[model samples]
Target: MEERIIIAGFGGQGVMAMGQLLTYSGMVEEKNVSWLPSYGPEMRGGTANCNVTISSDPVGSPVVVEATTAIVLNKPSLDKFETSVVTGGNLLINTSLIDRKSNRDDLNVYYIPANEIAIELGNVRIANMVMLGAYIEITKAISVDSVYKAFEKVFGESKAHLLPINKQALEKGAEAVKSLVNA
Candidate 1:
């Protein structure tokens, strides 16, 4: 299987981190993967995006012109990347910050109130994690166990203390996706 994904939002929203986690997870599962990140000059609040490709075969390129999936965390990202999704691709949107919707009918769209869910979970900074969890559930491209291992690898010993909350965010995101799918 080959899946190209783009995750985008403002910097400090964990867009790159999310990409890192997915890449790590794919590595743990022994999948060929690539991650490339881009950000504007303003740093924290600047626009940030990353392209991630996971494949069962060797990956040839890291640049993603048309993605198989898009996890858009803001309205601007939606505006920029919505059209970049290939036909019949997946689009996971963070609805808490975005009031708009994708008008395309060819794609499978999923929406999550990531920010609000993170806030409800007592950590507003984990909005990206929430979105990640939802994407995992919807796509089943990577296993939850692999994601846990990814967390262990990416966050390492220094940030080990944050694992519980991060796992919670992932579970919350998966649950959110399950609800949407069931509906």
Candidate 2:
């Protein structure tokens, strides 16, 4: 089970966080994982993305030329990585930020209202976590339990107080995707 994932969004939107969460969660599950982050010059409000590869076997490279899944958080990201997803792969779009839908029909496309959900959850910062939850539900690439375990390591122990809310956001995202697919 090899999952090559491309997660793209504007800087400060936690694009790298999502990638890292996935990579770390994969590691917790004892899977081989690689994470490569890229971003524009500006730290915030600029283009930022990451390529994550998780598999049962050794990862040949950290770069992902073609992704098994593409999670796009904004319009520009959607435009940039929509075609990167392999046929029959998953394309999870944050509908809260991206106004349009994908033109491709070859993949399983899920439009999740990530930002809106995070806002509803009382913190817009967890929007990335929402998307991460959606991806986990769709792919089952890593267990939700692993994600919770990796949170403290990723966000650090000082911010451990935020764990409960973040966990809610992840569950909300998973619920959101389940409804989307069930519909």
Candidate 3:
């Protein structure tokens, strides 16, 4: 299956990191992957976004005009890409920053208070990881174990000490949605 995901947020919110982790995990899974980040002027607080494509076959292009899923970490990101997400696609919004919802009816939207969950998990910086977890649980793009391995690979051993916490953040995100669905 081909999956295209766009992650957008303000600078320092770990949008780029999210893309990197996804790309890394896809590679580990031996899937074709491409990560395209919007950098330079747009990254300085204006609007930061990254496109990640994971497919079983070779990826044709990295630039995504439309995506199957969008992980939006801020309101501007929600406003900017909500309308562009493919019909029947998934949108994981960081509700801590977005107060509104996409009016579209053809898509499935998830409002996850990633920042609040991350803060409760202790870092507040792992908000991206929380979103990643929700995306993984919703999309099943990669296994949870694959994500943990990717995190360890990317963060290295010294900083890898934080892997468990990051994993916990991801689990909390998944659990958050599970509760919503079960409720």
On residues 33-109, what C-alpha lDDT tens digit does candidate 1 reach at each position?
99998844655576799999999999888999889999999998999999999999999999999998788999999
TM-score of each: 0.95, 0.96, 0.95
Candidate 2, residues 52-156, lDDT tens digits: the string is 999999999889988999999999999999988899999999999898989999999998999999999999999999999899999899999999999999989
Angstrom error at residue 132, model 3: 0.4
What's model 1's lDDT at 55?
A: 96
Off by over 4 Å in 1: 39-44
Superior by lDDT: candidate 2 or candidate 3: 2
Question: By the lDDT metric, which is better: model 1 or model 3?
Answer: 1
Clash count in backbone of candidate 2: 0
Per-residue accuracy of model 3 over 1-183 as CA lDDT, tens digit each? 999999999999999988999999999999999999997666357889899999999999888877999999999999989987999999999999999977888998889999999999899999999999899888888888888778877777787888889989999999878865456
Order the candidate numbers by lDDT, best to worst. 2, 1, 3
Instruction: Please count the clashing residue pairs in each candidate, in the order shown.
Output: 0, 0, 0
Off by over 4 Å in 2: 39-44
Backbone clash tally (model 3)? 0
Q: Once superposed on the true structure, which residue ranges of model 3 sit more than 4 Å away at CA? A: 179-183
